[model samples]
Target: MKIARIETFLVPPRWLFVRVETDAGVVGWGEATCEGRSETVRTAVDQLAELLIGQDPLRIEDHWQVMTKGSFYRGGPILGSAVAGLDQALWDIAGRHFGAPVHQLLGGPVRERIRVYGWVGGDEPDEVAEAIAAQVEAGLTAVKMNASGRMSANGSAAELDGVVRRVAAAREVLGPERDVAVDFHGRFTLATARRAASLLADLHPFFLEEPVVPENSHLIGRIAESTAIPIATGERLYSRQEFLPVLQAGIAVAQPDLSHAGGITEVRKIAALAETFDVQLAPHCPLGPIALAACLQVGFATPNHLIQEQSIGIHYNRGADVLDYVVDTRPLAFVDGSIERLTGPGLGIEVDEAAVRDADRRGHAWRGPIWRHDDGSFAEW
Candidate 1:
C-alpha cells in the first residue's frame, strides 16, 4: 500500500508519536522522540515525510535506507530518532498487512518472554531501600537506580561512600534474589567512575550504566578491566557505526534505545554486531508505550537480548505513565518483572489514538532537568 499521509503529535510527559497512513486504509503508529528534543525530531519527521509520501509503506528497508542514507548528514539523535519512529510505523503497517506480529516476521520469537527491569530512586537517590522494597512488592525481580546526583569529576571520599551506601541499601532490600542495576548516568569522570566501580563491587549489581559519557568509550576497556560488573552504555549512541568501537572496547552490554538508535531496522544490525563481540543487549527504553512495544518486538527476536528497561513509575513521568497512552495495557503482559511475548500484529500494542489526539491538543514541552554542583559548576543530569 502506498503511504498517503504522515502525522505527528507531541504528547504528555515528554513523548513524540508519529502516525503513517496508507492508501489501503491501514495506519501505523511510531514513537520518534529524543526526550527534550521532541519538537526538533517532529520537524525532522516532517522533513522526511516529503520523501515518504506516496511511497510504498511495505518497503521498510528501502524507506529506511533512503530516510537515513538519503540524507548526507544523518545518524544523530534527531535524524536517527526521526527515522526510527518512521521505520517502526512502516514495520507496523507491514505486519498488519500480512496479519502477523513483527517478531513472526523477524524469524519468529526465540523466547516466550523477556525480563524487564524497573527504575527505583529518582535522579538524586534517596530512600532507596524503600523504593526497592516497593518495586519488589509490585512483582519486579530487578530494579535500577541512579548512582549519584551530579557527582564531581574529582569526587570526595564521602561521595564514594554515598555510592556504596545506596547500593548497599538496595542489595539489602533485594536480599540477593533480585538484580540491582546502578546507572552512573554519564555523570562521573574516568577517575571517579573507576573509584565508584571499585567501591560498589561488593553489591554485585546487574550492571553499571554509562560510567562515563559516550565520548569516553576508550575508557570503557579500562573500566571493564578494573571491575567485574558488566559495563553497559550506548543509550546516547544513535547508530551501529557509533556502537562498533564501544563493543570493541569490551563493553559487556550494549543498551541502545530502539527509539533513538534507528529503530528495529538498525538496532537488529547493532545487536548482531554486538553478538560478534559476545556483548549482551539490554535495550534502553524509558519512553512511552510505542517505544516499549517496539523494543519488545526486537528483544523477543534477538538472541543476544539480556533484559529490557521500562519506565513504569519512573521519576520523570509525573502524570503520564507508560500504560496511560495505550488502549490495552494487558497486552503488555508484564508478569513477575518480565513481559510475555507480543502476539498481536505489528508492534502488538493498540495505541489509544483518541488519547494521543487529546494529549496532543494539550501537548507538553518536557525537558530534562539541569543540575548544578555545590560550587555552582555545571553537572550532567
Candidate 2:
C-alpha cells in the first residue's frame, strides 16, 4: 500500500504522536516524543513526511535510509526521534498488512512474557519507602528511582549518606528477592558517581543508571571498571554509532529508548550490537503507550532483552496516563511483574484516536524541570 498521509499530534503530558495512513486504508500509530522538544520533533516529522508520501509503505528499509541519511545535517535527537515515529508507523502498517504482530515479522517471539519495572519518586526517605511499597503492593517486583535530587559537584557527606539511607530503606521494603535500580540522572560527576557506586555496592542495586551524563560518556568506562555494580546508560545516545563507544566501555546493560534511538528499526540493530558484547537490553521507555508498545515488540523478538520501563502513574503524567489513550489496556496488562507478549497485529495495542484528537486540540507545552544549586549555579534535574 502507498503512504497517503502523515499527521503528528502533541498530546498532553509531553508526548508527540504520529499517524500514518496508507491509500489502502491501513492506519498505523507511532510516538516520536522528545520530551521537552515536542514541537521541534513534530516539525521534523512534518518535513520527513515529504519523503514518505506517495511511496510504498512496505519499503521500510529504503524509507529509513533516506529519512535518516537523506539530509546531510541529520541524526540528532530531533531527526532521530522524528524518523523513529515514522519508522514505527511503517512497521505497524507492515504488520497490519501481513496480519501478524510486529514481533512475529521481526522473527517471532523468543520469550512469553516481558519483564517490566515501574518508577518511584525518591526525593525524601519517607516518600521513597512509600513509593516502593505502593509498587510492590500493586504486584510489581522491581522498581527504579532517582539516586538523588540536586546533587553537588563534589559528593557531600549528607548527600552520600542520604542516598545510602534512602536506598537502604527501599532495600528494606523490597527485601532481597525484589530489585531496585538507582538512577544518578546524570546529576553526579564522574568522581561522585564512582564514589556513590562504590558506596551502594553493598545495597546490591540492579544497576546504576546515567551515573555520568551522555556528554561525559568517555568517563563511563572508568566508573564501570571502578565498581562491580552494573552501569546502564544510553537514553541520550541516539544511534548505534553513539552507543558503540559506551558499549565498549564495559557497561553491563544497554538502555536504548526506542523513541529516542531511532525506533525499532535502529534499536533492533543496537540490540544485536549489544548482544555481541554480552550486554543485556533493557529499553529506556518512560513515555506514552505507543512508545512502550513499540519497546515490547522489540523486546519479544530480542533474545538478550531484559526488563521494560512503563510510564503508568509516573510523576511526569500530570493530566494523562499511559493507559488513557489505548483502547484495550489488556494487551499492556502486567501480571506478576511482567507483561505477556502482545498478540494483536502492528504495535499490538490499539490507540484511542478520538482521545488523542481531543487531547491534541488542547495540547500541552511540557518541559523538564530545571534545578539550581545553593550558589545559583545550574544543576541537572
- Residue-level lDDT tens digits of model 2 in 176-280: 999999999999999999989889999999999999999999889999999999999999998999999999999999999889888899999999999999999
Query: lDDT by residue for model 1 over 1-381, one digit each (tens)?
Result: 799999999998899999999999999989997999999999999999999999999889988999999977767899999999999999899889999999889999999999988898635447798888888988889999989876877989988888888888889889878999999999999999999998888899999999999888878888988899999999999888899988888899999998899999999999999999999999999999999999999998999999999988887897688899888889876697899999999999999999999989988888888889888988888
Against the unseen true structure, what C-alpha lDDT does each candidate score? Answer: 0.91, 0.93
Deviation (Å) of 119 in candidate 2? 0.5
Give TM per candidate. 0.98, 0.99
lDDT (Cα) of model 1: 0.91
Q: Which candidate is the best by lDDT?
A: 2
- The TM-score, computed over Cα atoms with residue i paired to residue i, of candidate 1 is 0.98
**Model 2 segments more than 4 A misplaced:** none
| Full-model lDDT, candidate 2 | 0.93
Give me the runs in candidate 1 sitting further than 4 Å from their true place.
none
